[model samples]
Target chain A: MGRTTFHTDPVEALAGVADGDTVLVGGFGMAGMPVRLVDALIDVGAKGLTIVSNNAGNGETGLAALLKAGRVAKVICSFPRQADSYVFDGLYRAGEVELEVVPQGNLAERMRAAGAGIGAFYTPTGVGTLLAEGKEQRTIDGRDHVLEMPIRGDWALIAAQAADPMGNLVYRKTARNFGPVMATAAATTVVEVRETVDLGAMDPEAVVTPGIFVDRVVTS
Target chain B: MTAQQGLPLDVSGAAEHPEPLDRAGLAARVARDVPAYAYVNLGIGQPTTVADHLDPAQGVVLHTENGMLGMGRAAHDDEVDPDLINAGKVPVVEPPGASYFHHADSFAMMRGGHLDVCVLGAFQVSAAGDLANWHTGAPDAIPAVGGAMDLAIGAKQVFVMMSLFAKDGSPKIVPSLTYPATGLACVDRVFTDLGVFAVDHERGRVVLLEAYGTTAADLAERLTGA
Candidate 1:
């Protein structure tokens, strides 16, 4: 079992988060964004952060608030230009922030590969597009695939619906997006849940993320 | 790779067909064409409306890139749950048999070719079936692909839903893409407000299968996608 600690304070749980760290934020958009953790991160005053998420951010809150604070140095995301991604859009246009656009499936699979301890893998997702340029390509069984490497994270900030004392988690609906995979890929995985249940209360099969992958759990 | 050249609807026989469909009409048309019980994904924006037009009895399941399958229609009133949202960040309902998974597994379903059909909105589609929906190639435009590239290449059949002509009155179905490409030779069928088109990537041809409120000859004359 992983030594996962439970926290009541967001700032205290995110105390170790430092500047220039690569942070993987688990959310499809605002749905799974760990709002409390992000707020605490902003309070932690971490600078030059590299954020990885699906959407850049929505409106002037959560991830967008962090980006608006000019704390993010780069964003490695599948989609960065949503309707209210003004904070990121402005920074990108001014050359203040760096961006790496990956195909959505490739982004998810790369993180999955990192967590699964797999080396590089190939897929036909981005083949023949600008994204596959100058990359390794192989003809596997008459189909071409573009080689993509794993993307590891220094810390993962994810939100879930419920968590047990051992850090076993269950998410609600589509909010499960990147949480489970990100929890496995990061060196330190911290989660925010709406409530904490007793141990053994969660069914083993129903747990989206096991306790072994989580390092910290905070009830917010 | 060779697109089968044919028409399900007769455009040659009917001199007077129905008027060009409005947004809802176009969506209904696309929904009607989806194979029954097929696993489908509707892209964001106008393409999302296709879900509303689908008949619930058809058993067509919806897949969202965010990590859901068997997604229901948009959530409204008190049924809305922030956690139960779609790929577009809009609250959605979960129908019976709805399942959730991690991002990796969710996308694997798409890239693994389990999805039967995916309807997407495009900025332009080449005669060779190339998709240019992500970036406009403008110097100042921020490039954000989302799942456009993956869905374009991964789906068994990629159906493009958009107006045939852009707001500037330029045809969206072109001989070649003017914008940065999302995927090459990916689009299978294109359902536009004016007509239905099939791109034969092998022959680099775009065939006007059917037209509405206009004649196929007029579309053929206007479209440079041959």
Candidate 2:
């Protein structure tokens, strides 16, 4: 059993988390992501965090805040674009922020696996070369597979269009990236929704993440 | 490695069949200069051509930021495997013992300083080794920067390939840059249609390393001011 609490300040609720935590963020390139929460964490000076996002947003907008603050230690991402003020590049060259670049398709699957409670899965993603190094390789039906592990987070910070008292979430447009998976993967899921709705007010199928997977709900 | 026979220049006009050089020759030239066993990231466009000319017999290992190792050049139509593609989303072939990975983990490798060399295409590269290839804001332009930034900063050595001059005879390599920099002072070597040059860091000048048939003065004339 777990205890629940509420706060008017999202930062106060998030401040309970410690440093060096792995945080799964929901959003696609500047889409539906927890921008405010990310900024709050940066303002609080959280360091050594392993950040998982689709793409670090344009400079001064999304994950770039945390990146510019030099609080992120490692980044697990799909595409590393430069128009983002080259902040990622500067960190990379300085050996400050470690990076793991993944293919877009595999990134989705890895997040999906975490949400499914699978600890590890095998695929043909990386089998022959350096990616295969130190990884378990198996042949399935005359084909080779490279073993990959699911990525879960201590907390999943997500942004949603609406949420209820019980934490049912609905995303708007492109802001839904990896949100559902991240919601299920983390032990505690914290969300920042645009609108707070009464429980049972929303339709069933429209809710992407159920209240049970989510531990806390923060509305902005 | 064998020397490529130069293409005979057209005396009549600037247009000639095949432009006197095949893709293989270009690939070979790019591959010849890269040191063996160096972790290499091949950029999209012409830079991918190096994979074809790589003498794997020389022990060069190619890496795709998309989580592929032991990568080879673009596969022939008959050998094409749709599932296997480079970052550019073009079908490619994987050499023996090639491995795939979660895209995130692949980026980790690059950010971890494991890559030794990154070869990329460029719209312009200053004598100071600054690169700007992603966007010109031109109409019909596919606005993108892709992994060029990561590759530029992550790799130990940055190599650029491009024409010395734009179509309008405007020099792409200049004393200083006009466009946004991809990576500041990160480029180590450059290969152009005219020749190869390296950064003379302290002097802020480009040092001529090789010229196909052009002189250092002519190269400097185009790359630097009088």
Per-model TM-score on C-alpha atoms: 0.94, 0.51
Instruction: Mark the regions of model 1 whose C-alpha exceeds 4 Å error after superposition.
Output: B1-18
Q: Write the per-residue lDDT of candidate 1 for residues A31-52, one digit (tens) a residue.
A: 8889999889999999999999
lDDT (10s digit) by residue, model 1, range B54-167: 888998999998989999888999999988888777888888899988888888888889899999999998888989999888888888899888898888999999999999
lDDT of 2 by residue, A1-220 (tens): 2243445577876866678999888765555667778887777777899988767556776688788888889988765664554777677768788877654445656777888877887765434323346889898877566677888888888877787776777765334546776788887788888887776798987777777777766766
Q: Second chain only: TM-score per model?
A: 0.91, 0.82
Which stretches in model 2 have alpha-carbon errors above 4 Å? A1-6, B1-226
Error of 2 at B177 (Å): 32
Q: What are the RMSDs of all candidates, in order?
A: 3.6, 15.0
User: How far is B118's C-alpha from truth in model 2 (Å)?
Assistant: 26
Model 2 TM-score on a 0 to 1 scale: 0.51
